[model samples]
Target chain A: MVKLNEHDGSIISVQDVNFYYGASKALTDINMSFKKNQVTALIGPSGCGKSTLLRLLNRMNDLIDGTRVEGRVYFEGKNIYDPHVDPVDIRRKIGMVFQKPNPFPKSIFNNIIYGPTLSGAGSRSDLSALVEKSLKQSVLWDEVKDILNQSAMRLSGGQQQRLCIARALAMNPDILLMDEPTSALDPISTAKIEELIDELKKDYTIIIVTHNMQQAARVSDETGFFYLGKLIEYNQTAKIFTKPDLKQTEDYITGRFG
Target chain B: MEGTRHTSSQYEMELQDIKDNLIYLGVLTEKAIASAMDALLQRDTNQARKVIAADSEIDRLDMELEERCIRVLALRQPAAKDLRFITTAIKVNGHLERIGDMAVNIAEKAIILNAEPQLKPYIDLPRMAEIVRNMIRESLDSFVNEDLETAEKVALEEDEVDKLNEQIFRELLTFMLEDTRTITRATIIMQISKNLERVADHAKGVADMVIYLVTGKSVRHQY
Candidate 1:
């Protein structure tokens, strides 16, 4: 229910939201807000519904069977949960990157241009320009510029992950939802992704779900600590990690309990 | 659950090691201050020598703790609370080391005062050392438990030590003015008191760092 100003469009807002899996509730009375040009990290232990919460933002949860969501999700001041809202259109504006690097079987150029083409962006030159812009935004343009025609699957796991990020950027989404995007990456790759996230925050609103507390502390402006399907604490990332007001948050961050 | 619990246990063990070493340094300095005071009060040269000998261990542990803090900073790249902890560890290590040196200063003054007959009973100097020791212990506990309020309280107590330092200097001045024979002993005791005052100042510095570590606000210049 928290609201930010609309200077840069306020990005996404969740109000009194609830989710259920058949007869069991997965999220309860959740209310949160994310602003444009900032990174908000969702942190909690496994099975804490942090990933579920991320999916709910972009309506990716709609594909899951027996999953029921209630309440409103607003993006750009429009209610995304309205009956007439198209999930495809909503997803086009809000892109997502998964945990594992799942690059397509096509070339690196094709991987970057695939989403824009599917969305019917423009002609070949337009797609090429968009591809270059996206890759450059993700800081991967120079490394793979010579091999644009090569298969993306041949790239290393870290490179593929950055390629996936570039693919998400092609659509020029207003918000990006990343679910443990660097969990499978090595330390060097993790550092690169973290740096990319930092740079991206100046242009796009980012919501990241990370189990690594250090990553949350490093890359996030705000952090929400979720526990047992509830948002236990939400505050500035520095406060959450240094001196959390809640004992549960303190215990979790200090490694006293999880 | 087992894996998570194991990781937490290891983290706790590392934290406990830091806590124990800090307390060990605290106790050693506290004892050195007490014995240094005793040497000045009762003209006990042997106790002053013991205080001097004990300072070497305090110096050794200060280096060890500082190196550990640097290693943690390089290896863990800790953030937030952990980052504050390592940073505070470095500052507190310096404070404790300075406190040890002040104790050595007191012991040197005590040796000189003991050789001369005696200063007059030495009341305020012992009182200053006692307060400094408590400040040392409380500051370390504040850091070990991350208690911001306790750290703030210790910071406030520094004022009393400062006042006592002034009072001791005034009282010794009167004695030096009254008798020429009392001048040498009174001056030496005044130096011992001044060293105790500096130890209290260093202990307050540790307390200030603890407050910063807990609240992430610098209170170095503030009262």
Candidate 2:
């Protein structure tokens, strides 16, 4: 077992981790660390376990049947997979945003406040404050401040995605895990979200899994390249984009092969 | 390796086109340098004028290559070594184009020197020009082959050109001191030697970019 330490700037550390979906393995012997207040991007071809690794961070895979995670994932020096630890508590500290904008059928106000409301977090005024602060953090406050009562489904895809981000931010997570957050977004919206990500990194540790190489290059401080269930290379985003240490990483990023 | 074909054949072709055009540009600049030096040694004003006229094509290709690199950046959004290659291509393109300008500068000075009586026998100047020409060739060859050894060879030749340039200047200085009439023609020859040295420096610049493209490290001012 690797000794886990939290003083090293890393907020989460994965050591000797292997994951399986029933009998088939999905990730193998993965080891890496995510630093505080920095955006780390996980990039690889589709089904290369990049997204699977992102999901493993907060134990989101526990919701899937017949899936097992071996080894330890330390979050702030605590093993999240320990039976004594609560997965719900781990999740609240590490929020997530999905690929598509899956806002609820409720009003936009409800969508932002829903997570806190279910947790009985605070009073009505506190919930309203949380809604405003989360929306502002996601950079969607001005767009939807007047339309709080409108159904979230009525918002555009990009707005809905930002609203989902706001929904996650409402939980006040220390780390935000995004699995291809802007894959479905248009260029303009994507740029806005990317700008928001740059802004949000000052306050939150972000781990993003993206298939868009340029987006990974643009938004990430550190980038990890995964191939066939193994980490091929991990380095500064500039180094990874300009001159990766591994030929397989270079080949994939250059669009030579998947 | 760069030899692997891109999944998008069109993108692969676009990158290949830049390489081809650079090689073509390299050939033109090499010819201009050789011709300019030939004109100087043979005292042929007409050949010098032809070298001057040939620079417009090099300038045109420089603009064309820059636009293509920008297009690839905006469209294909290349990454890793391809990104390095394209960005390096932009820089190497500038160096090659400037090499062309240096050749034209030499040719312009050659025309002036050809009008007057012959200066001292052109021994060191021709040798310097030959080495500079080879520097440009080897630098471009390193870029095309991604060969570090060839790029290092070009860097080593830069010092050789510098030594020859100094040798020519010191020898010419004695002539100007002994007889002031030789000052105008000797100074023009000195300018031609300086231009050749500058061309060698530009070739070294191309070699530096090739090193960056191959190894992802900048060796510009380090040595």
Candidate 3:
């Protein structure tokens, strides 16, 4: 197997991760690692297994009946799919954000505090401080501080997406899995989330799955181009954007034969 | 790679337009250098004036090629090889335009030298001019064909032009030293040789950009 990334100190290592939806193979022998505190973007067309690969990182695929994943997904150092390992615990550590803003029908404050509350978090004042810190980290505090009690659904599409990210951060996760986190937002909103991702990578390892090639280039430290359930090429984002070594990767990004 | 056609023919044609304008600019600059050499060798002031007048076309093409490159960068958002090619096109466009200016500089000196007596047969200078013109032609051809061998060949041939330039300078210095009356013509001939040397340098620059476009390895400042 040719490895594009050689990060020795990987936070999450996916080795021969083959996933299947009943008889159909969704991912074929994916071998990659998300390094500590670095943003890795998975880019490809629809049904290319980028999102499936992201879901495999946090074991979100376990919930889907008749779906199976064969191989190891080591988070920190332990294989996440090990019999002794708990998927719920894995989910708590490797938080995920979806394509559309799926904030609960609760208030903005509730959205940030919901994940912490589920895991027997802190006292009333402690939760409030946690909410404030998470909102500030996600860069949504100033816009929504005065309206913390407002329904999260009332916020704009961009703000809702940022709220979703804030909700994920509130879990104090070591890694963040974003599957098309900015696809539903407008350009301005997408730019804000992209900037937030840049800042967030200082402390958290980010593995984003985006269909937007330009956004992947703009935000990720490394980019992996997947085609037909296989990682065609992966390299530094600058190399991927300006001079990809593989012709398939170049053709896809430049829209020659995507 | 050349056989692989872009899905969007308009974008492909826009890229091809940059290449076409670049080659056209190369042709005009090559013509300018040849005309300047012809004007100097035959002592034709009218031919030198024609070389000077024709440089505006290269200048205009330079602007057009740069604008086209910018459009592809802005609108098409070219990636990988296309990105490399457009950047190479813009840099090569500048080199060719500067080469055109150097030809005009040579033409100006040719007009002045034609006013006076011949500068003792003009052996190495015309040879230098011909070598510089071939360098420009080959450098552009290497870029158009994505031919690394021709690009490397252009870089290798530059040393000969430099050697000729030095020989011409040393021979003319002896002419100036022997006869004080010949100093004016000697210096003009020396200036023409210097301009031809500069044209060779610009051709080498184009060759370096082509090498980078093909191999993504910069060979500039290495030679």
Tens digits of per-residue lDDT for model 1 on A140-194? Answer: 9999999999999999888899999999989888889999999999999999999
Sort every candidate by lDDT, greatest first. 2, 3, 1
lDDT of model 2 at residue B52? 92
User: Top model by DockQ, which number?
Assistant: 2
What would the per-residue lDDT of candidate 3 be over residues A1-258, giving only the tens digit for each residue?
112233446788999889999999999989887778899999998999999999999889999999998999877667889999989998998899999999999999999889899899989999999999999999999999999999999999999999999999999988999999999999999999999999999879899999888888899999999989998898999998887888888788877874
The lDDT per prediction is 0.84, 0.91, 0.89
Candidates, DockQ: 0.39, 0.83, 0.66
Report the poorest 10 consecutive residues by lDDT, candidate 3 chain A.
Answer: A1-10
What shift in Å separates residue B177 of candidate 1 from its native position after superposition?
5.8
Q: Which residue runs does candidate 1 get wrong by more than 4 Å?
A: A1-9, B1-7, B71-90, B117-121, B137-153, B174-187, B208-220
Q: What interface RMSD does each of the candidate structures achieve?
A: 4.0, 1.2, 1.6
Best by TM-score: 3
